[model samples]
Target chain A: MAEKRLMYGNHALVEGIIYAGCRFFAGYPITPQNEVPEYMSIRMNEVGGVFLQTESEIAAINMLFGAGAAGVRATTSSSSPGISLMQEGISYIAGADIPVLVINIVRGGPGLGNIAPAQSDYYQATKGGGHGDYFTITLAPNSAQELFEFPKLAFELAEKYRNPALILADGLLGQMMEPVEFTFEPIDPGKLPEKDYALTGCRGRPRRVVRSYDLRPGKLEELNWKRYKKYQEIIKNEQRYETFNDKDAGLIIIAYGTCARVASAAMKMARDKNLKVGLLRPITLWPFPKDKVAQLSERIKDFLVVEMNCGQMIDDVRMATQFRSRIHFLGRPGGGVPTPPEVLKKIEEIMGGGR
Target chain B: MTKEVIVAGFGGQGIVSSGIILAYAGMFEDRHVTFFPSYGAEMRGGTANCSVVISSSPVASPIVAEPDVLIIMNEPSLLRFEPRLKPNGLLLYNKTLIKSEPKRSDITIIPVPANAIAEELGQGRIANMVMLGVLAKKTGILQLATLKKAQRIRYKKASEEQLSLNDQALERGYSFL
Candidate 1:
């Protein structure tokens, strides 16, 4: 059934988490993302789950450690500075190989940035903000429907790799309201399979230990290598991106999240002018969708990278193409969004004013 | 067909809620709709505005750089947003609250005495419903019947009397032209 309803992006994320069988949510109140914790306060209780308004972002992530270590699907959300404070805890979670969901409703940043939408944290979320030789599965959603659907996918991916998953969204997507069609049945956490590594009561089984450090000699190296193999497998298996009007095109626009929506509008404008312009939107920030870009480079040459930041994801696109680099960037730092007309102008300039 | 509308006024006025009601009604009629509020520190007892998009196709960007229709509920918002109105667009302002007239000659300008009409029906807060009624009768974007149903969802806590007051305000503005 096409079960559609109008809801805010943050509220959709909460419902997505609850529907994915997440029984525990811990978060602190922050602008653009306050709705996540605020809605959780009520919906978690209604779903017989636990919602904690923690004193700080640090406490929230550590609380998630306790719940996640016990084999419960636990999560926490915050904005830029708050995400920064959770770095140590995230490193701890990564070190212990825990499956947890962390959401960053990103805002303009570097310091105490204003509460407007920005994608400045692309490097932070994808390259592992916390100190470790570890990577989290990162998913970027562009619409309210995708916001509603990505949580379940993130949870499954996190559990599959026994790693953390980050949903890198922005304030614009969080604050906007749109109709969302629920696609999946609500998952029942009760009937789910038991996690073999959980520190649940050691009633009949041997006591299990979960820790990030193996302090004995080369033991830490061995554990790091093991996680490396998992990352390699993930890199080989998981790379998600979207393409529009890519065939027989000379230029393509690469963006993600809110930026991609604007790029799409610009691409439509280009197409209306009969320009051979296309769009490539990466859904998964990690694993980077490099292979697709590399393949598309064989046919398409010029690429425009639009973002709400000065330029972060542009590095990934450059590395993906490797010296065939005809990449142009349009960015609006400090929480401003680039409009379709401005983006179209860039596309036209890159296209020599026409195809 | 796609229609982008911006509703602007002071904080207490139902500017954001009016956008939501329009979007909600658009959804009921099988149209793709998006409502985005301009949320900032400026919204605290200050000027507030919101963007609403109703489209036959999927909506692209939630931000409205150019609006097909501009609904001004206060004096400050008229000059702030009037320049962004599309050529030959509709400029609908509340005559009761706004003293300045739109100077655009290309666009169709309508000044509705929304506050006065709403006061005649009891509350000045429901003047947004009056503006919505004018928008409905002019553009054919949404229906008054569907909007009434959508308001019940938006004002779920409103008493029967308040709801009836809103319906009358809409009815009065719908035929007031």
Candidate 2:
């Protein structure tokens, strides 16, 4: 029998990790995202997994690096402030090419913002999330069901590319509860590619060194170029997005995660009023689906980018459209969630003939 | 068709659960649904609210700006959200907790002493269920069987005694309606 259960998005993440065969977790508790680690602590113990509450966000991410280098599925999560502390470790992990799942349940700010939901981390998440010439596969989930399903996808992408994967969730998506249909198929941990590069105690083979060190500048540059080539391949093959009502749409709204949900509502209301507005929601933020946006720009006269931050993703939209279409931006910064009416008003105002 | 609702009350008043049960029922009825709650520090003593949207098509937005229905378990919630009700919308208020009456003429207001009725039913917490019962009777949005399934699904992990109390709460709430 198909059963429906109400679960918060953080709880859904925990369930998704379990479903994805994640066996280790190391994280520091932070506002709006502490529930993820708290739930993992209890559930991990019950399932014979490991859950460690580290002293700091830096320590937590380093612990993830250690666990992931040992070739077992592992994860670490935090908010913006905590994620800032983890950037150094994230950079190291990205450099070492270790597959780890990092979840950032975003809140407001450049530093120590309020606990309210915000998408201000868009630039940080999509711009490699750390100091490196590498990319983190970022999945933006808009709802509880997506929260439950994206972790599995995150793990798959992380392992496939041997890179750090991120689920860029906002506080609103993390806290909301919705009816979710859990997938029944169990993820096999053994099915993942054996880490030939992992340091596994040197059992019977040559000791492996998992570092990004290079004695010569040319070698380091070569490695960076190879990583960029891999990213290019990802951009070509793994850009996932959803388009709604865009077949004959006059106005196209580009949004992702929580803001995308709001845009969907506005689009529905506009459609009811016989307005030719549609939505293009990006599920994969890094491999940004630039081609899809470019294709839509050909048909639509106007493109509106909505987000929880001030013109973060809009930069990417502009780059993709190459200023071909009239690009407009609507957003709510500093922990405030924009209502559907607010978005609708912005849409109408933008389309009301003032360029 | 989509029925969007906002249920608001104190933190411990089971307002979130009421929204959850309704959304679960929607799933049982093969409708796409979403339920969203206010979280973090606001969940402790502040007004707790959850938005539920049930629809024939996939739900577009989980946030309700102008809700089609308002289930208020307290005066604060009633006063706060009464202005956001669509024209001719249904308002179910817990008369025991909400002493003041709403002055909106366009909306149909149903006042029920849900807490008092639940107290008589041997538990005050079941007031949420009683409100749900009235909502079911008034809207006929989901079948009783679907609600029963939802109860089972929600209370699957609880002990038998706890499950029995929840079952009784649903029955009493339905009968009151």
Candidate 3:
């Protein structure tokens, strides 16, 4: 039987990572996302998994990098500032083409910002917070239920691409509780893709070298091209998003994570008053569903890009529409999340006079 | 149909736990539920609250601007949430803490002495359970048995004495209405 229970988003995410065959976890405590590691501290022991309270976010990501390169399904979670500290390790992990899962339970930021929900990390997560010409397959889950599914999906995608997959969640989703049932079967770690490049004891076989450094002049450029080709494949085959009430929508709201959930409520409110508004929520922030938005932009005239940041995803939306569709941005920079009524007001403002 | 509820009170009043219990009851009855609690500085002994939305259909948003059921456990919460209650909504408050009555005549207000009832049961900390009892009976949002079942599940890990005291508080509060 399918397991059903009420779970906080952070707890569900920890359970999801465990169910997805993660045998190693290392992270530091941070607000909003502290529950993720807290739950792992207890539950990981119960599952016979290794859990580490690392010294810092840098140490945690490097631990994950080591575990991931050793062909073990490993994970690490942190909030925005902590994730910022993991960028160098993430860049190395990507450069080495290792499969690992990184979770960012995003809070307000620019500098030691408050621990409230924010989607300001869109650029940081999708546009490569790490210094590299590579991308991580990023999944944004709006609810605790989706929190259970995305970790498994993230692991699978990471293994398939031989690169890191990130789960980008906000403080609201991480802290909120909702009913969740594990929709997928627990993945067997033994059945997962075997990394031929893993540094296992050789047993007379050829030893594998897994490092980010490539000193040879042309060799480094060739390695970057290989990474770009893999990114293109992820972009082509892994783009994911969801559309609601868009068939006849005169206005479309582009949002993700917490903003998408609020926009869904606003969509219902607008429809009740007979306003033709719709919502397009990107489930995968990187490898974003630009084609779907482009297809809709041909039919829809007005687009409202709502976020919890000072307008980051708006750039991607404009790029998707080729700057042809009428676009308006609604966002709060730091801790404030726009409520459903506020989003409904934005919808009306856009429909009233293109304002 | 969707029922949006806001439970508010000072810190340590079990404001967020009350919302969680209500949501658990809704889930027990096979309804979709969302529970969003206040975070950050508001959690440090100041006013705290949580929003719960129970719906027959999928809950769109957890943010409840105009709640159909507004539960205020203290005077500050009443002042903060009273104006936001929808017209013809159900307003449940603790008469023990809130001395004044609600200003709105458009809604149904039920003032239960939650603290007094819990004190009678020898556990004043379970006042939120008392309010939950009144909410279940008055609004018909969840059946009495369902609420009790939810309480049992919530306190499954709690001590035996604590469970019985909560049971007494809930039944006493239910009978008060």
Candidate 4:
């Protein structure tokens, strides 16, 4: 039987990491995500883990990079501007093939927008925020239960691919409280193969240097190609999404994160009014789930993309449909989230045009 | 059945805590529950509110636009949330703090003098608990036993006397109507 516990989404993510055998947490305090570090600070000691409150986001990511390089399950979390600060370090970690968890409890921003939830980081998170030819596996969770389950999945994927993984949650999900049944069991951190290539005081074995830099030109190209090959393998195998009421529907709404919940509610309202609207929620943002979108295009007449940011994921929806189907966008940036009624209005407008 | 509730009041009036207790009671009974606080740039002594939803099935939206039950702890909360309550909804307010009569006739309004009752109990802060008791009795969303369980869990860290005071406040408020 699953243990039922009521927790904030941010706190749930911390519990997920702990269950995933994450023993090191280094992060700076930021709004909407402060609960994560606050919980970790209190709970890490009980589990004999290390929790560091870094002076800056830059310092925190680097600390995560160091801990990850030393082969410990480590993570760091921040909001939009703080995520921006850690871009270079994220690129370096990916290039070095180190497994780390980067959590962005996203708030609105081009630069310091506000402390409200927004999906504005879609591009920055999925399209490689830093200077790199690499992609981090980005998981988007809509509720507190998913928030509890995704971190363990993130860590497993990160370790399997030898790359970084991101949990892209928003302020609403982070701050809200809900009852979540934890599904994953705790694992012993000592039993994992984290020490195989780790720089653990190499006495008899060869010293392993974990780094992203290659001074020679040809060698760097070879490394980049190898990384790209692995990323391609990830793209082929790791796409995850959920389709709601769309198998026989005419119109599909593409949404992710907290916006997906609102879109789901809107779809329910539309169905009540005899409008055949459905929802396609992307659980993984980086892999994009393009194949699923393309398949749905055969039956669906049009698509509506809802987001907290102005038209970020809509571009991906258009790309997936190849600009063949009518794709529309409904967004609210700089703070507020779209409600079900607002999404229902947009759905009705699209249904009017589609018919 | 699904129930959407909005509890609104001044920041220190325990509006958010009442929502938490309600949601906790729902969850303890094996129902899906969500509690969303109005946050960000919100300061103490300002308007504060939270939305709580409880359902047998999964809750689709945490945002409650038209609540089935609206609890107003102050005048500003009354003005702000009165128009948003659904038709034939349950409207519960603190009659001691709110002087004006409700304008709508379709909804069932329960007037509980929670502040006066809490004052009589020798602690003004327990007014929210009194309101919670009335809510438990009037709506049947939570049973008196479930409310007591929730109160025990919520104040597990408090002294025994404090817990008893809250229980007294709750019993007083539940019978107020």
Angstrom error at residue A333, model 4: 0.7
> Which of 1 and 2 is the better model by DockQ?
1
lDDT of each: 0.92, 0.86, 0.90, 0.90
Give the per-residue lDDT digits (tens) of candidate 2, residues A1-355.
Answer: 4465668889988989988989899998998987899999998998889999988988899999998889989999899999989988989999989999999999989789899899999888889878868789999999888888998999889988889999999998888777777866657776766788877799789888888668785999889888888888888989999999899788999999988989999988777677788899999999898999998887777898888889899888888888888998888899988888888888888777422
List model 2's recovered fraction of native interface contacts, to 2 decimals: 0.77
- Candidate 2 vs candidate 3: which has greater lDDT? 3
lDDT of 3 by residue, A1-355 (tens): 5757999999999889888988899999999898999899998899888999999999999999899889999999999999999999999998999989999999989889989999889999999888878788899999998998898899889988899999999999988899999887777778877789888878899878999989987999999998898999999898899999999899999999988988999999899888999899999999999999999989888899989999999888999998779999899879888989999898888788432
The DockQ for candidate 3, computed on C-alphas, is 0.85
lDDT for model 1: 0.92
User: lDDT tens digits, residues A22-86, model 1?
Assistant: 98998898998999999989999999999999899999999998898999999999999999999
Pick the winner on DockQ between candidates 1 and 3.
3
Recovered fraction of real interface contacts per model: 0.66, 0.77, 0.84, 0.68
Candidate 1 ranges beyond 4 A from true positions? none
Question: So what's the TM-score on candidate 3?
Answer: 0.97
Q: How far is candidate 4 from the true structure (C-alpha RMSD, Å)?
A: 1.5
On DockQ, the stronger of 1 and 4 is 4
Weakest lDDT window of 10 consecutive positions for candidate 4 chain A: A191-200
| Of 2 and 3, the candidate ranking higher by DockQ | 3
Alpha carbon deviation, residue A22, candidate 2 (Å)? 2.0
Question: Cα RMSD to native, each candidate?
Answer: 1.1, 2.4, 1.6, 1.5
Docking class of predicted structure 4: high
Best by TM-score: 1
